[model samples]
Target: MSTSFRMPSIVAALGLAGATLLCTAHAQIKVAMVMPTTGPLTQYGDMVKEGVTTAVEMANAAGGVGGKKIELVAIDDACEPKQGPVAANRVVNAKIGYVIGPVCSGASIAAAPIYNNEGVVVITPSATSPALTDGKNYQFIFRTIGRDDQQGPAAAKFIAEKAKPKKVAVLHDKQSYGQGIASSVRDDLKKAGINVALFEGINAGDSDYSAVITKLKGAGVDFVYYGGYHPEMGLLLRQAGEQGLKVRMMGPEGVGNPEVNAIAGPAVEGMLVTLPADFSANPRNAAVVAAFKDKKRNASGAFQLTSFAATQALLAGLKAVGDNPAKVAEYLHKSTIDTVLGPVSWNKQGDLNSFDFQVFQWHKDGGKSPAAK
Candidate 1:
């Protein structure tokens, strides 16, 4: 009779264990990462993924949000505008309430509307085009990076004050991000009483920029600012050097990849590019930095800390108002989140209230430092 009684209790205990496991699975909060996992910008995507994953793991280790674990769902948009909406829909279909990327500006712009309509909160770590949030009151969209308009003025001021070039030329890839920033820098340079000798657009995938280099040389441009990705920028640098066009080249954050050195060879050295000031050196982020180092991940890349901060912002919103995307969006709009990037607050337009954009000089050794004034 004792054995019979024990058997029934054992069965009940097993049933309870099964139910607990089911509850644990159901209680997990899902967050999606939409970025390029394939294609030219894969390294940038890897940096963002590492940062987001590390931040989520750290959060989970600390008992998670409200005792529920956070689950990551990664979707590759290939950094292409055409693929962005497709990835956004995939996240929506999976019922994910938050997203940490769509790292490239073109992808983010394409995906923003889908996330907004579905009430899924999207916080892009690196997409900085002013068009993303300029006039759209996207309740579900936010960015950790500064807009191109803001970055443009910073670059323009630096050029005017430091480079002091008598003739400058502007080039772009004709995409939203590339063209918008080039235009902003052009306007700002003009406003600064600097002469912009040439402004043109180049096809992104073309292997040669010899024709463009000839134009720049003919224009007598001492300073060349190309608003595009590393691929074209690298080709331009290498080709310009081969053509004996001695000029200083600069670009926006899109061109701030270490891979540029491989493509441009020695020409990448001394190339100035604008990016967010490094935040990994902050003493407050020591623990986070150590965690990344322990995992063999770089916490100092262009998007790593910003992506971590984006995850933190999402988690903060979740903690404040539960997992509802709308509530989280409202919470984010009203609250200042203390994250790896330090305290951050968003304006009504879903852009950060302020972000420090600075210029860095790239080295052929795959390292970068603050540009000398």
Candidate 2:
């Protein structure tokens, strides 16, 4: 009788343990990362992923949010506008209540409506297009980074004051993000009474930018600003160098990729870019920076810390109000959360209340230093 009673008690204990394991599995809070997994812009996605993955892992090690482990699901949009809604639908279908990014501005703008309408809270770390939140009134969407307008002015200020070129030429890829920022820089430069010699659009994937380089040479511009990604910027720089149209070039953070170094070779050196302030240098972020170093990731990349901060804001809200997306969105709109980027709060339109866009001088070895004044 004693043996039989002990057997039943042991079985009951095993059953209870199994039930707890299942409960923990079901209690995980799923946050989807909407970004490019396959594309030329995959590096950008990888940078953001490093940040989100680190934040999630650190949070899980600390007992997770509201006693639930956070699960990150990657949904690829390929940084293409047409694929944005498709990626958003996949996240919605999987019932993920929070998202870390749709990395590029065009993709974010395309995906914003779906995320907002479905009550999913999306915080993009790298999309800087002003049109993403300009008139959308999107409560469920937010940004940890500044808009292109903000970055544009910072670049223009440095160009007008520090670089102080005699004739500036503005070029863009004619895409939404590139053109928008190029226009902003051009207008600001004009207002600052700098000569904007030429404003033109170039084909994005062209191999030869000699024609445009010829234009720059003919226009006698001393400085050029190209508002686009690194590929075109790299090509333009290489072709310009080859064609002997030697003008200093500058761009927004989109062109701040290491791949540009390979494309442009030594021509990439001295390239000026506007990027988010380096948060990895902050004393308050020492632990977080160490966490990144432990995983062999660089926390100083353009979107890494911003993405980490986006994850932090989301998790903080989840801790405060559980896994409800709408409540988290409301909380984010009203509350200031301390993140790796420091204290961050959002405006009614889901843009950050304030952000720092700094100038950096790119080196051929894929490192950046604060721009020399």
Candidate 3:
């Protein structure tokens, strides 16, 4: 009789423990992060991850949206356009209603249609191609960064007015982000009454840009603007220096990674690039900056704060409309929420109402500051 009573009590205790575990498992809300986890751009992916992770931790600490924990599901697209749809399908299959990236513009453009068809909301922190939302009816797609068209003109004006190169050369990686921005800048330069001497395209993964460098030198190009990521830009910078070609190089935000220092060495100094205006220095973001610092993460990188804002937007939308993605999308379109990047609201095409993209001068010490006139 004693054994029977003890066995029943033990079974009851085990059953209660199992119930608690099940409840805990059911209380998590899933959000996907689609970015490159392995590739030349992995460092960029890590930055996005750091920002998203910090945002989710802070949200969970404050009690997550609708009283549930926020769970991150990271899907790697390798920043490849071909891998983008694959990652998007994985997120859809996981039943995730929200996403924080597809960081590269090419990947974002490739994945946008899939997310739209599934009614899943995706807000990219770094993809800047205007084609993502330009004249499209993508209700489920949005970005925290300014479009390349906007950035291209800013770069053009800076080059035309500030750098004032006698002959300009424009080069691109031929990918959507690279080609699109280069084309825009080229057009804007002409519009500003500046002549672009040489416009060219290069294959991205090629180890040699020496031929292009030779061409630029031959054309007497004093300033070269490259529309691509840092790997190619770093090679160009290093090679140009080695070949005794002295010319100024400028690029878009894609070339702003710190790893470029390792790739270009001292050649990286004076390289100009455009990035979203620094928001980490805002007085209102003191706490957020401290939180990143406490975790030993650099909050000042190109996409850190933008990724955090994207996560905040995701959480805010989820809190407002629960698990209904369509309603969440509608809420985001109509509401202006306070974020680390300041008050942000989206237009009908899912572009931010306003974003400030400014030029920064890179230093060999792996630091960048706003360019002085």
Compute the lDDT of residue 350 as modeled in candidate 1. Answer: 93
lDDT score for residue 1 of model 3: 12
| Models, CA RMSD each | 8.4, 8.4, 8.4
lDDT for each residue of candidate 3 in 66-185, tens digit (9 for 90 to 100): 888777767789999998888888888768788899899998989899999999999999999999999889999988888998899999999988988888999999999999999999
Each model's TM-score?
0.92, 0.93, 0.92
**Full-model lDDT for every candidate:** 0.86, 0.88, 0.87
Error of 2 at 25 (Å): 6.2
* Candidate 2 residue lDDT tens string, 1-373: 1111110011111121111111124347878788888878888999998898888778776778977877677778888999888888887877779999999999999999999999999999999999999988899999999999899999999999999999999999998899999999999999999999899999888888888898899999999999999999999888899989889999999999899999999999999999999999999898888888877889999999999999999999999988899999999999999999999999999999899999999999999999975
Tell me model 3's lDDT, rounded to 2 decimals.
0.87
> Model 3: which ten-residue window has the lowest total lDDT?
1-10
Q: Could you give candidate 1's per-residue lDDT for residues 1-373 as a string of tens digits?
A: 1111110011111121111111123237878788888889888888898888788767776767998877776788999999888888888877778899989999899989999999999999999998899899899899988899999999999999998999999999999999999999999999999999999999999998899999998999999999989999999999999999999999999999889999999989899999988888888888888888777788888899999999999999888889799999999999899987779999998999989999999999999999976
lDDT of 1: 0.86
